[model samples]
Target: MGIELELHSERPTWTESEVWHTSRATLLRGSYEHGEALEQLLTRLGRDSPGGLGSVDRVGDTLFDEREAEAALREIPGLLRQCVHESQTVAVHDLATLLASCAATPGSHLWFMGD
Candidate 1:
């Protein structure tokens, strides 16, 4: 099982299965084990943190609207700095880059899909 981060121009119209199979959205994937580490880090950061970083559901789905993406962008740098593992660093950076793109594109959303 793994997690996928997808960028959609608007709220996706496809069903979850269809989104996985057919959507041509920008995507980044990571192992579920890696996601667990990321989630632990987020937990340490506190769930109520302003950027909603702690709200990511690593075993389910989480969606970040453009405004939330903008807030997350502000927190990514700090998150990256706290990463001790190289894979964690890469994941955080990749997520940040994707979120930044989503934030800049009006109406875009970032989806964190886990399975």
Candidate 2:
């Protein structure tokens, strides 16, 4: 049980036979350790209920559509500088990259699956 961030061409309904199938691009697969290390940053980003990085449930799921992704993309750089976890630096960078891709694509969405 961990956190997985995926980039999908469109909003996923999760009714697909294979959740991790070819419809999405796995951006980040973070273990409990990784999630713990980045908790501060995630919390600061905002809550998933408000279309931010922090998922509503620590073990549930959240989705960020193109607009939300763009909003996140704007804040990531400043938030990253405030991050103190060296181990999570790369993870955050990857997130920023994926967010950028999601923002650039018209109907793309970013999914945060946590468990």
Candidate 3:
């Protein structure tokens, strides 16, 4: 579960009531303290409760979307190229060369270079 925190930056300090309301809102919206929410969710699932099926998969899908993964994959080569171009010293060059060599080896390191 995730939360959308609306920080009241303009306020000098949050009142006790405001803090209580915010915490209540967060809990209502499925944000958990530590793994309590997940544990509760699993317990509910074992009992075949409707709450177990609510909002979990949607949140997970949004977090692990294909487009986001593709974008991260595309950025790696550009990052490596930038590192090589910005290497001004011998040590930096050596590090970049080592990285490039690792990147070239078949299945030696995880390279998600997508087409």
Candidate 4:
């Protein structure tokens, strides 16, 4: 079945914005454990996989450097076009902005969590 999804960019975080957690999650369609598809896309692109980002144990250790995060965010639209398109409210641009904000601050990283 071709399920159609509408985007909603402003998704609430599972915890405080800057707080680090044991597992990484994102605000996608469902809730706290949403965004598997998005994660898959990242995996396919070699950015992140099922286990983690491949480069690091992103669960509790992932740290998004401002410069590096910016670079990675730039590639989101093109690299994960399907993910961007599926999100009816959460535009890729918006997500990038959120992630950028997290990256800009101290003790903050790009970890997704929502419920």
Which candidate number maximizes TM-score? 1
Q: Per-residue alpha-carbon lDDT of model 4 for 25-103, expressed as tens digits? A: 3322322222444444444444443323333332332434445455566665554455644652344445556455654
Cα-based TM-score, every candidate: 0.77, 0.70, 0.20, 0.43
Go through the candidates in order and give each one's C-alpha lDDT: 0.73, 0.65, 0.27, 0.41
What TM value does model 1 have? Answer: 0.77
Candidate 3 ranges with C-alpha deviation above 4 Å: 1-88, 110-115
Report the C-alpha displacement of residue 92, candidate 3, in angstroms: 0.7
Let me know the TM-score candidate 2 reaches against the reference structure.
0.70
Scored against the true structure, residue 101 in model 1 reaches a CA lDDT of 81
Q: Tell me which of candidates 1 and 2 scores higher on lDDT.
A: 1
lDDT of 3 by residue, 24-109 (tens): 43221221222322223222232232322222232322121222222323333333343332322332233233334433432222
Better model by TM-score, 2 or 3? 2
Name the runs in model 4 displaced over 4 angstroms: 1-33, 47-61, 84-94, 112-115
Q: Tell me the TM-score of model 3.
A: 0.20
Candidate 1 lDDT at 4 equals 60
lDDT of candidate 4 at residue 15, scale 0 to 100 = 53
The per-prediction tally of clashing pairs is 0, 0, 0, 10
Write down the lDDT that model 2 would get: 0.65
